[model samples]
Target: MRDRLRATLALVVVGLLAAACSTGGGDKGFTGTRLETPYQAADIALTDTSGLPFSLVEDTDKPLTLVFFGYTHCPDFCPLVLNNIAAGINMLDDDESAKVDVVLVTTDPTRDDEKAMRAYLDGYNKSFIGLTGDLDTVIEVGEPLHVYVNDGKKLPSGGYDLGGHSTFTLGLDDSAEAVALWNQETSAKEFAADIRTLLTDD
Candidate 1:
């Protein structure tokens, strides 16, 4: 088990390197430059769960995005994190709000089509975007984000577990570079506050 986990981590790291080098991204238009990304990424293209082309190069022109990785079938963490996003977005000031986006990217592409993703996110806020693509493209996004979703299978009782996942959420600059990352546990209020600071700064 330990060896398997290590191998998985290694694979993620390698994938991240690939992502960092292959993207053709440019700068986001944020006058406030106080926040800097803790990690940098090579601009990459990823389709949202809605099957729309969402490229880092194109979309970063807007406000910062709070990106989270999870699947539709995830019974708990997925929804919980999204709810936090909704709450946080609601808390932003008008000007600050204009500079923030909340997006959900799915790890399970096979089961999470655009319709499925849309339905899942509808429970939270219709404005929240759900992104998914082919398994290969999905990996391209997850690797750079460093998210891992475990295998899912039928349990003895018949209700299959959607596999455990390492929770990953990040705040990104217009350049899609990671400015702040919140792992398994981080407060929504704090995340909201930090985003406001980033949005309002010059």
Candidate 2:
């Protein structure tokens, strides 16, 4: 069953990327063998939209996170992904909902400073935190998560395009650990269900 789920998930990743692969924490409770599954999440570092230091290490005590990377300037996909996440969170039971977090790690640090992030996130989910830091530091953060961004140039037409990048969504457990070999790449509806399961374990 787990193997079949993994296969389904692999295909989902491929499809999202072709469509342009697109697209938390805090302690509550639960001691069930964490990560009793097949996959686990990666650790990373970034700053929240408020410029708050968002070190993954610090969150080891918090519930796991659903991590996604992209820039705010992202034309369409970024917003859709974020809105989808917001929709998922809305489905959670109020109590279980407090155990998880959604993270937006920005690729366009040049423009996505604390003030910018805070403003951008206000439009959608207030629970969401956007993060950015120094270019080198941001690059380092993306490495472990396998997120990439290609050189972008200002177009004569005004806006620019993402030169190179891969969209990915990652989930982590409440112990600040990545859920082992779990299914990702789910829709807002599907994601909400997975989140509910994780919250129950918490």
- Tens-place lDDT digits, model 2, residues 13-110: 54443333211122233211123332333455677765567765564354657776666778756777777778888888777667777777777787
Runs off by more than 4 Å, candidate 2: 1-45, 150-165, 180-185
TM-score of every prediction relative to native:
0.70, 0.68
Deviation (Å) of 103 in candidate 1: 1.3
Would you list the C-alpha lDDT of every candidate in the order shown? Answer: 0.62, 0.58
Largest TM-score belongs to which candidate? 1
Full-model lDDT, candidate 2:
0.58
**Residue 113 accuracy (lDDT) in model 2:** 83
66 Cα displacement, candidate 1 (Å): 0.7
Misplaced by over 4 Å in model 1 are 1-37, 148-165
The candidate 2 region of ten consecutive residues with least summed lDDT is 23-32
Query: What TM-score quantifies how close candidate 2 is to the native fold?
Result: 0.68
User: Residue pairs in steric clash, candidate 1?
Assistant: 23-43, 48-131, 48-132, 49-130, 49-131, 49-132
